[model samples]
Target: MAKDIPAVAAGNQVRSVAKALMILNLLAEHQREMSLGEIAKEMQLAKSTVYGLLATLRDFGYLEQSPEDGKYRLGTRLFVLGNVVADSWDVRKVAAPFIQSLVDELGETVHLVVLDKGEVLYIDKRECTKSLRIVSQVGTRLPAHCTGVGKVFLANLPAEEVKSIISTKGLSRYTKNTITEFHLLEEELKQVRQQGYAIDNEEIMESLRCVAVPLRDYTGNVCAAISVSGTLSRFEGDELESIVSLMVRIGREISLHLGYRA
Candidate 1:
């Protein structure tokens, strides 16, 4: 028969650490702001232990007490950490010149995007020299199935994760051209993987057309995408092909500079 180890001697420390991490995760998921009693009940931990952890976190500035109700919430430390991560991305540093050159050569708007959860997050953009413009802000997020950059990123994801995301964030149609059906979107993604590029044929906005190429990382994984967007009237046949080639080239260049091989 196996002997049972004492809690204090062997497993108590690990259990305590696990509980503490669970508490932190819960707070983060809830966007912080929880009363002491609420936190203890949610974590299924003793009130004394929860208080000790909260006090320690407060001392370290990882949490703060609400001025009005004495509830606890995430503190400035998280903002400082988030800023550090944003600074590290420094996408503009590497992508700006390429985007400028593309805009000069193709006379179209260029955009850089990264996948965040189920959305395409715009990190950088360069508007065209043309008088007619397609407005897109740097911090804007859009549905993955309806945009060029989003399609490229989604094409590279594993099938299971794609299905999961689609199930959670349903394929909402933004325009008549949008591919809202799950099976149809899957087929589109397969074509993108085979062709090495994606096209947004007025899927997100009427009369707007766009093309995108995957931006890979050091592990040869698609981590982001670069795209060129313009009016459908301006993008047709040979001109569209030219812009697609340029975007693929620029995306590869940026990916390589970011340590991607292949």
Candidate 2:
């Protein structure tokens, strides 16, 4: 009947959306580039139908088409959206217990941070009963060049991206230990990569020392960092080594919860 026209159109629209989602899932399952013909054949849909859905997804940046092979793959927009979802439900929930354990065992403060807009954004912090406490608080931003957690993140980023961050957020000196020169900071980051950890030796605040390790996601990419902080006297000789080793183990365990393999 004529009255059934709108209902039929709505059903068609839902089918189109379902097909589009199926295409995305297929790409994810294969984890490789797929051609239009291949996708159409795999989905058992007509080439024209697949083409329309692919075109829509590509236009919205949900998919990318290679110019050389004309194959399609997931796009950066999906990564951005995925990170937003992960931030809301994954990292913080996964890291909380480990962070608390570190504070309890080490008798020092611990912090979890992520790099945001070339700055270190503190998302969580656990304090010990020590008389001296870190001045930083959760939801606050700090200079990436001067903090141990910040350096761990910056060290993992691309050189060009790091340089861009330095250009935008100049290396303002907080203490004499702060790395103010680009060449020196580059060397510091290189050392961090080689050593698998980073340290802040009175760089941000006088007499405060921090040891930090990077946290990876399921993709094996460094997504965040965790740091243990205390006074200079507490982090020396064999004590510092023990802290570093423990934090590294804790970092790995937290990363595993986020689906990181290694």
Identify the candidate with maximal lDDT.
Answer: 2
Per-model lDDT: 0.83, 0.90
What TM-score does prediction 2 earn? 0.67
Structure candidate 1, residue pairs in collision: none
Across 1-262, the per-residue lDDT of candidate 1 in tens digits comes to: 0012134556555655565556667788897589999988887667898898888778888788988998988878877986787678855577778888988888888888999989999988887658248667877889898999989988999999999888988899888999999989999999999989999999999999999999887889887888888888778989888887878788889888878877
TM-score of 1: 0.69
Q: Write the per-residue lDDT of candidate 2 for residues 36-153, one digit (tens) a residue.
A: 9999888888899899999999999999999999999998889899778657967889999999999889899999998899999888889988725778888789999999988898
**Superposing all C-alpha atoms, what RMSD in Å does each candidate have to the true structure?**
6.3, 15.2
TM-score of each: 0.69, 0.67
In candidate 1, which residue ranges exceed 4 Å CA deviation?
A: 1-84
